[model samples]
Target chain A: MAYSATVGSVRHVFPDLKTVLARASPMRSGDVLAGVAAGSEQERVAAQLALADVALRDFLAADFVPYEDDEVTRLIIDTHDAEAFAPVSHMTVGELRDWLLSYDADGTAIAALSPGLTPEMAAAVSKLMRNRDLIQVARRIRVMTAFRSTLGGEGVMSTRLQPNHPTDDPRGVVASIIDGLMYGCGDAVIGINPATDSPVATIALLQMIDEIRETYEIPTQSCVLSHVTTSITCMERGAPMDLVFQSIAGTQAANAGFGITLDLLAQAQEAALSLKRGTVGDDVMYFETGQGAALSAGAHFGMDLQTVETRAYAVARAFKPLLVNTVVGFLGPEYLYDGKQIHRAGLEDHFCGKLLGLPMGCDVCYTNHAEADQDDMDTLLTSLGAAGCTFFITVPGSDDVMLGYQSASYHDALYVREVLGTRPAPEFEAWMQRMGMVGVDGRVRELPVAQHPVGALAELREHAA
Target chain B: MSGAADDAGAGAGASAPASAASTEPTEPGLRVVDPWLELRRFTPARIGLGRAGDALATKDQLALRLAHAQARDAVHAALDVDAIRGALDGHEVLHVRSAAPDRATYLQRPDLGRVLAEGEAARLRSAAVPVEAKGGPAVGATSGFDLAFVLADGLSPVAVQEHAASVLRATVSALPGWSVAPVVVATQARVALGDPIGEAIGARFVVVLVGERPGLSAADSLGLYLTYEPRTGRRDSERNCISNVRPPVGLSYEAAGHKLATLLREGLRLGLTGVGLKDEGPSLGA
Candidate 1:
């Protein structure tokens, strides 16, 4: 194919947005001609980069669409390393363009520039470039590919196994976890919402999950989604606590359900830290939130949903949460109302959360009353996975017996792992391999479902029969 | 760009961004050729509508404004008792209202939406309907019926005006051997209002079909709530809610009615309605 045809084939998908894309396309620059004409590939690439800088003047003059409160751009600009990035600072736009072109195949070098020049600064400079420049430069900026930065670490997809029990009974809990982990879940964490609100019940439930992890020698985290006070009480009482769990809204008032304030959140963090339970790392807060929470809690102050949702991230960042999920469809239908809105809200929330620097997760779920079905959640989950979502909640039959709604299933997690090349967190991945659930080929095994009524239920069934 | 391109290309339609935070090209008034225009001709969902400067074109904006007005009007619109009565072929009917006297009050104070009018509760209290031996009633035994329904002009009266009677009349025949209470046609009422009316009528099972909040795509949508034994202060989990009742796009009235009938029949059989019961059992194809 001709060069124009090759690019045009990609452009044909969004033919209407051509003009908008053209502004971003490096093809609009003839400076690549220098590369095309040069004697060596290296020199040609250099010439192309030089021309990209020459085209920067046009980008500086081009009219652009305005963003409302672009925090990403601000971060890049705010953290520019003038001394370390003197190479970038002193170079002309043309020279800088060539320099960035050189790293098109190298992610580590691209990541290295973040501290030296800042991601926000690199992003700001890239903003002025054409589409070709944007795509070329954008492809290289992968961060923390080797280091496990608290989240399932970089370069892998993960899920938190949420095996909720109606009574938080060991039987129900054990059955669901066996099913989920066998299908290769719990890479992110194995969290559960306690059926009973009592601290004793909640603590027992936490211990139960912890015991299972120990029994199987599973390298995963456990959480009980009762109030933070319950987790804190358990921590203080020497219970096996992995992640401190809470439901946070955008504002203090919205957090009333969790009985949370920044101070209380801080106190909970201190308490959880005192427990010293996180074996992997100290980052152990798990917060679940949704869009209309602030507005429903009467703390929106008329701010837009997406804008207000980002503020919740500030709270997440404060605790340095291990996982932050926006339960987009769990809120009432009045807020999201339908499949399309739910899908849009999930993406917007993910984008905003990821931009605000959090390992964002989504409960791609809906209720019986909602106009949405599993299909909508699938679309959102697939999109989020491609966009680098860290985790999601899994259910046994895709239904939360106690919470009374439906979410992603164990089937969904296996499907994500199969399709997206995502896996449970790295440490957990090794455990799955050791257990022979994960193949040497890196595919999760389709293990047969465990017979339910195990643990307490098994004894009851045995006695009754 | 044609209106069709807007819908099909929403996510796929980003161009190379400008130097600033601008996502759109600097060019103004120049139209770009749209590839998804043909695909866009398929759905009426706000796709592919061309843009004017920064906002929607005049025609699109006006249509949107019109839809907004229509939805608002549906919320504030009053119930037509005569039209409703004309549509129904029921056992009996009683017209009452919620405590919120007007639409404005109902919008502002949701607490009032849950209760019946001052004398309305008394009417239910006073009206004694005979019942079968279906484990008696949970609340008002002598006053309530075996099963009751409250048709409320919830968020959108337009939905009730259009769908309620047709749906109820169709579903009634499917419900066999049960002594259903007189249908309560309520004004400015919410789901919980059915509980008090059911309590007054001494109903064992209650279902409320009310107008759902309108979405940008569908305005005249309806919602239904089914409770095994409903009463005041009952939590939402105690009831099984079925929503998005409309036509051509949403859950059709017939399907909604069938689902309601199935839940009620099952609830009566199992002596339950809400949490712990799954709708997965014995699908009535509702």
Candidate 2:
């Protein structure tokens, strides 16, 4: 089917839904790299105008990627809730945007309508939104999920204390962990991205964090972000496992490039559930997705990068994941270009994920080669916080030496909480208050490590003893 | 230096302020340094940085910004071709450029960096020095040479400028009997740029020593990629990489050369250079 929009003397036509979606997407280098981006700024606005009139129901009628060819397409088609979609079936993408911002689409209303919305519909409506519209709509929806600690609640934000080390040294990892905990971070999870993907190294890192969590009685989970198969092997070896982590993408082929499948993820989830590790709930998966993964893997199949990224949320929501975040700028300038593009993509991912009833977080980060700085990250961090983002990835001093990029520091979390009046996950906050690391007013106590009430590093020495 | 040297003494013992009696009125921007700041010795990660108020201390913040600035500069830094030529004084070095016209285009369009400029391949094919084959009639050889060595500026020209010549010298000396082609010094090049250069030289294997993307911590880290059969459009899985060749902070020049030599010996023996060829030939000690 052809879609057209006229501006002044020019009439632009999009050949298909995928073309319209690609043309309407906010300017990003990845789409341009794929040669699917609109030819000019006027054409982009026209595509957005054309996209707004497409009915939400049309997204269901045809798949952007054929179902027989793509398993991700198959998952979207098979899992769609016709009953839930009946309420908004008649609305166009433009009308849906209006309804989303209206008084009628409250937290409960959006939650009820979530099952009815597919990733494509969510992606479609997001194209018609400005950054503020994305923020305002996402702010209203709360996708609360739990493993040991609950995430995605009103007036609460969580952080993934990513204490990554260059060589996965236990001492270096523990030092950062101690530093992050003192700053009142790690409410979501103390997840580590091991520099090496070997199973033995992964198990050692897992055991180290587990010992710390057990010794200190911190109310949170720990994960070593290795490949899913390595996590599975660690689980089989009786290692202390919490959330199973994997980097997922939108297309089946892209997932294959990551050496994963739906069946493999299910098996990993089943293994984690069998461990019976969580005290609060059984949402035990941690997923990381980004915009350029599919395109980088040569698996985008002609869709825009953002639309493909939204499809990843469909995969995440299927498993009731405890945490799912878009590593927004980690892919670097080739995809998101610079700070402004990274900031916009972060909000779009959060809005789309939250709108689809999945707990969404963002790695408000950038690589050195990208045209960005801490100031840009500050903008995104503040923006995502205002949008009630589920969590942020907090590294030590905002520099991840192992991953070789910059992310929000543990102190950045404190800044956002103070600015937005958001606290850590409830269980983690209570633990910190009990330990005197934070006060009841949700302020992290600024004290030297030795003088602080929680002498976490000293405790690590004693544990070694 | 106490905690920096002694791993076990890294906590508060070495990190506390010099004297308790020296306490004075705090200045407006004064930061309460983490008593265990000495632990910074253990990793390059920015840790134990004292916070002023749930934020990085001014010095620490500026240090991070400085590191970032340096890394960005490393990406845009031009390679000093004469310096590299001076380093490898005895070797026959041929200069070439990739299809990318400038640094900005090279950074954004990676595809442009993988191919040579319009006449570069043709020029190399006609002008390359002829060499005798070492192992008679190798499985993948299109030309007489067994291996082609390429040095590319890649994302971190700092890496190429700092370590490429020394590493290349060490690697060449280690491969005693192998028929090696004249080294190609490529500007604005990616790892895959070695393919057409190698194919033009008719070598069985291509080793591209290029500058890796500059990380905030290590700006001059070099990477070595080896591809067999020497052709365009080779999948990444069909290549083996030995990365982080910057010294002291990363792999030393000698160690990277040793690893490359091992991979070369095994790759030629196995007649492959990718997933099929693992780097288990021998340790540097062996």
Candidate 3:
């Protein structure tokens, strides 16, 4: 479809024409004046007005046409009149240039009128006008001014925690990981565990790495934090050498603990500095830590559930001084040796309450194995929340495991309410009050009134007096 | 001839006795045609390959024909660099030489294809190197080109040959104000090499379209990788990717382009890349 071009210049129409000179002389109130007056301001004004009339007519008739099926044309046509046309004639060269440059008025009117105009069409029109050089430089300046008004900023940090087994499709695994990193559980962390380490699995992992690098533009380093294993090696070695070989080549597992810790530290420092430097006004730091290899008795890294909790608590305490925002808790090794229930019952409590300071938190790992029954999940969530957990990330039985995580997250929310007596408490103040009270140091403490009887309150007051 | 006819007649008469004595008619019919009795009547040469002599073909022949057809198609559809240049309106065409001398060589030598050609330095010098700001000189700027387009011959050349235009159109449509540089087609390239292309163009954002490895079900899938403030010496952690750009199994061009644009805009806004930007999601529709 053909569209009309919007021209902002009068010189393009009349190159030789300078400011118009009026031939008619102005009439005095008591005396009749006739003929053109030499250098009369009134005459000049009349001439300029006539020139402006011509320019306005030409603009309306030539430049302002229906660009799209929109209200802009109707508004322009309805608004166009002798009065509107005359104002342009009175404008000085500078004023005219400014008016032309400020395409925002015209553009906005057009946009308002043309509700059906697609973004592409709008872009095309904008491009065409800019290319024609008829666009007023003043409009450019206007845009520049308004651009600052729209200025807003955000920051993101992504990390991928590798899984224990080789997955069927590594690309899917990586996508899920990145998705988790972006919008999974609160704080945005993703975990992966492949079932085996066959060539197919390695290829899948590599493919996932490639996809993250290529499709998502995630830095290979941060996108994949570490590939983990619960056991250093499986003792059952037999005909399938690939599995054994994979276990032996567990490089990611070996390096995961240190790698993830260092990554978290670096990310935290970066986020903190970004906030400090005013580069990022808002900050959310995420970390994905797993204990897949910790499931095996022989593969213990001298840190059981309690030790992990204490270490996490220390880390959280250290980061608290820096005012880091958002910490995600991910649990791994639930499927190690086919979900044999290796960990103790109070495991989540130490980590969630004592360490992370989360009254309710999500677990990032779930596999379809022997131990992930509904009851087991309910018990785990309840104990974790009571001990201060808030979110649990569980995968579905379908091909896309992340969808399952979303489903499990809803169920987990319910479980938290049912078991821990903590509902979706948006107001932290109310939550703290419900819990009991806050100490002067911002720690949870018993309310003085609750702790003391009504008569004891008076006694305390009397003691203070 | 008379003796043969008489023997045939006597055999036919002997078969009737078997047919009459049997309780089951079907069993008697099979007994009458017993191979042991008929074994002396046939020769080995007449029994094998006699009914369908000319119809059968060997497996090797079928494989050979299939390979020939593939080779023919590959040659016919090989991208014409000249045609691409004409389409780009006098933009200098960059021919990235893979270390692999030929297609076979290219397959084995992925590293060779990742580097720019010898003449690229001079071409880059002659062309306007991306500047951070308009007044800035065309060389050695901190922020580079407003936009950069990188094309790679990933696992499948056919993918590049098929989807380049559509992907480019979608991308250009999404980015309204940015100045898009000419597309660079690289052979035998990997994903990590996009950093250099960004550096070469001095681009704020680098978008690479490459062929994805063909699966058993899909042979011509395309993939895209976009990075914000892509420059030389940037680590792999500073980029994001959009994979599976072909239809059915992956994102369509329009969707991928829109997402890429959103990512770039978000990255630029945040001054961060990789995992930081992954969660930002698309801002266009939202």
- Which candidate leads the pack in DockQ? 2
Query: What is the C-alpha lDDT profile of model 3 across A1-465, one tens digit per residue?
Result: 111212333212222112121121121110011112214444434433443333322333432223353232333344334443354445433344345445543534422323222111121122112212222221111110000011100111111233211223433342233222221111122333434434444433444443333342222221122221211111111111111011110112322423333243434444333433221122222232232222222222222322222223223322222111111112211212111131221232222222222121234333221123334444444444443332344331101121111113322332344344443222222333343433465333322221311112222221211
Better of 1 and 3 by TM-score: 1
Candidate 2 backbone collisions, by pair: B143-B202
**Is 1 or 3 the stronger prediction by DockQ?**
1
The sequence of per-residue lDDT tens digits that candidate 3 reaches over residues B1-286 is 0001000000000000111111212444453332212211211100011001111123322332343233224322345556555555545456554344555334323344455556663465446445544545332125555677766665556666767667777777887766666577665565545666666666767777776543222345577777776654565567676766776445787887787777767776677778777745667432
Instruction: Name model 3 segments beyond 4 Å from true.
Output: A1-247, A250-465, B1-78, B86-93, B98-100, B129-144, B279-286
DockQ of all models, two decimals each: 0.02, 0.32, 0.01
What RMSD, rounded to one decimal, does every model reach?
A: 20.3, 5.7, 36.6
Q: Report the lDDT tens digits of candidate 1 across residue range B184-253.
A: 8988787788778777777888888887755333446777788777789786678887766777566776
Question: In order, what lDDT does every prediction score?
Answer: 0.58, 0.84, 0.35
Candidates 1 and 2 compared by DockQ, better number: 2
CA shift of B152, model 2, Å: 0.6
Question: Among all windows of ten consecutive residues in candidate 2 chain B, which has the lowest summed lDDT?
Answer: B1-10
- Candidate 2 at residue B210, lDDT? 85
Better of 1 and 2 by lDDT: 2
Of the true interface contacts, each candidate retains a share of 0.00, 0.51, 0.00
Q: Tens-digit lDDT track for model 2 on B177-236?
A: 677778889998988898899888878888998887777757788889998888987877
lDDT of 2 by residue, A410-445 (tens): 889889988889999999988988888776655888
TM-score of chain A of 3: 0.31
